[model samples]
Target: MIQKYPVGIQDFEKLRSENFLYVDKTEFIYKMADIGGYYFLSRPRRFGKSLFISTLECLFLAKKELFKGLYIEDKWNWEQSNPIIRMSFSNIGHKYLGLKDAIDKRLDEIAEEYNLSLVAPSIDQKFKELIQKLSAKRGKVVVLIDEYDKPIIDYLGENPDKAIENRDIMKVFYSILKDADPHLKLVFITGVSKFSRVSIFSDLNNLDDITIDSRFAGCCGITEEELADNFVEELKTLDKQEIKRWYNGYTWDSSTSVYNPFSLLNFFRKKTFQNYWFETGTPTFLIKLAEKTQLYDFSEVEIGANALAAYDIQKLELIPLMFQTGYLTIKSYSPMSDVYILGYPNNEVKKSYIEVLMAAYSQSDLGYGVVYVDKIRQLLEKGEIERLEGILNTIFKSLPYELWQKENEHFYHAIIHLTFSLLGVYIQSEVQTSDGRMDALIRLKDFVYCIEFKLDESAEKAIQQIKDKGYLVPFSAENKKLVAIGINFSREKKKVEEVKWEVIKA
Candidate 1:
């Protein structure tokens, strides 16, 4: 029997009634409703935020018939139901019409649903009045907002001014939640980023942010166990490890990571390995932000707990935004210092991101990058030193003039880092070897290359430093061949000026 996979259908009642495959996340929903009064969750786009919100809608409405065999069926009270006020910002109207107009239109729709009229002059007042009126008759109102930051996120890159304006409108609109707290049973808001308090959540500061909260870490996305238990038939012919490598490393905390539900479902439907999650949309603004900030050290990017929670359009930080937006994820956590080390979540992201970055920064064709990666891999495997050097020179020489003019060392390092990474080889950036930290370490099946990159310095010095530092001492015993490569870039030319290499054994 072919199971119906809910690809774009977020309506929980329809999904359940139509016999679609639903990974039961109601247990978490039950715990959250029973435990909290107000909550905020941050996850990437298409990571099941909409579906989660829809589930909460059904749950709050006490639609017990839809959840007959689910985990929450026995645990929840079927007799008790609250009037649900659901709003999603994904389809909010024309940007030129402004956010206030969109809010008014949405409020009018809601008012019609309740068979009432709202005469409030502003969005905030309309929201407040609706909450009071609904809860007055229904006992208490349940509020669930999906894609709460869509209006602002959509305008972040092109119209930053509008983004800020929309944020102000949203701040005013969401502020009504706090005022209507007395009549609200549960308030749940979900978005892509945790916009800082002063910007978006100032009035709603009491809301508990369960983004990194360990208890609800598995709430939004499909967990490894959930996938195994629910989709056993889908796994019989699939490479489980490939699926894990492609979509299984999005982490909220340091543990209990989950797969992107959109990608996993598509993988089953399509029966192929591709970047389904990224293909939905890659924010050009975020990539441009990284390039503008010269954030090339993709490996050791770290953020404090406070910084990670900070998201203001006026003063946005690259590390936190990348981590929150799903381009990068929590690699590790330091309990003592309250910091998170963030990196590309999985192979799918790393590859897609590099292609995006290269295209954005260098205007290089993604297909060309893939071809160059294959050529470079073959060159390294055959120990073609001079040809490999020429390839590196060509890669740098082809960089766009605007990017070349920046002349930032970090930018150049990013180019090199991405080059080796695309080849699917073992690449350790800034590897701490026996004596000193090596710039990069690349390992293929038959060869190990110690790479040292220098600016405004001789290539000979780079190789000597690698040798002096005993960067290859740890690999001396390995039977595979070893090579030390030194690459030097000239700031004036904005390209590789010299290349030196020493093969230890073959």
Candidate 2:
């Protein structure tokens, strides 16, 4: 019999009662509970953060039947149970009611659920009253807040004033936790972005931020071992490496990479490898920020440990935003300098992101961008060097006239790089040689194309530069045929002006 996979299930009790397949993350929960304290975790959206939050709620509520065979079943004391004030910000109607009013309403609802009356007038006062009352009535309370940054994040790109207003509201609201610490058993907060404590959790200084802790690095995502253990039958017919390429490689620490839980589960359910996670939400703000900064490449991005925690709404940084939001992840880390090397976590992210960038930069729809990439891939695979000029022209022609700027060359090169990079082939841009740099190099099965681009200059000169710089010298000994192509873009015409190529027989 096949197991039921929970594709979008976030309720732990419902999942367990319905007999859905669970990844058994209770061991991490056990460790966290055993060393109890206030904890904050930051993970990308759809990484199972909500489900983990729900699991914690069940554990604290002492739902022992839900944890029958799980790792924490025998370890936890079943006799002890605490009152849980679980609140998820994502569904709290913050947009319609305003942040302060919405929070106040939610607090009132929680108090009513616990059969208590909170006569406090203000939001923070009400929260403090609820905590104190709950602890006084039935021991200490376990506070679980999920998507704590949603209210602020939802308004970031649209309304800065609203975002800041929400931020201030959260600051005062969370400040209640500090004074009510004596009544709190364990406080676990989860969100996508980690605003500095001084901003949101200023008063709650004792909160332990385990966002990058190695011990809980695998807390939210599904590790390779977990995948193998949980989905043994599902892996029988699928290519493991391909699946990993599409959905794996997300890591907080340099080691212990895990698969995107949403993507992995959808892959098993649908039996198709599409952009499962990326399709759910497009990073429109991040894409615009990238375009503003001209940050098309993330291959060599590095930031210090302090930089990861340096998120500010007033002064938004692109790299850290992308890293915290899942566009870029830790590729490597230098302990000596406390710096992290960041890049696209997997093929799904890289391909989908470049497609979005291509569409945005070219002022075309996503369908056209994907079709353009397919056309380019087909032309390159057939070694039809001549036809590539027309497709390249179409790509540039799609760009609006006003979007062109003084940095025409950079714009043109960015489109070209994005085009080839989406092909999922071996491609390198601005490759350095002993003498000069090659514009682009594409390695196909039977042909290695050394490509050079020039603005206003003649294609013959562009082709000659490749030869003069000995750009093909490195690949000369390979078994494939060598081909050099020069493309010249006309700034005046705003399209590809000429294309020239020379085939050197291998």
Question: Could you tell me which residue pairs clash in candidate 2?
Answer: none
Residue 26 displacement (Å), model 2:
1.1
Q: Write the per-residue lDDT of candidate 1 for residues 1-506, one digit (tens) a residue.
A: 99899998888888999999999998889888876499989899888888888888888888889999999899887888888888888876736567799889888888788877888899999999888888887778888888888888888878888888888888888887887888999999998987654568788878898889999899988999999998999899899988988888999988998998888899899998888888788888888898888765575577888888877888778888888889899989999999888888887788888878777666777656776777777887788867877788778777777776665777787887777667652233346565656777777677888878888998899999888887877777888788999988887777788888997653
Question: In model 1, what lDDT does residue 406 have?
Answer: 62
lDDT of 2: 0.86
| Residues 1-506 of candidate 2: C-alpha lDDT, one tens digit per residue | 79898999999999999999999999999988876789999999999999999999899889999999999999999899999898899999998998888888988898888899999899988999999999999999999999999988897777878888889889989988887878988999999988545699988889899988999999988999999999888889899988998899999988989999999988888988788899999757888889989978775588998987888888788898898899899999999999999988988898889888888887787857778777876787798888988998887777777778655777877887787667652233335567765767777777788888888998999888888777887888888888889988887887889999998654
Off by over 4 Å in 1: 94-96, 401-411, 424-436, 476-478, 490-498
The lDDT per prediction is: 0.82, 0.86
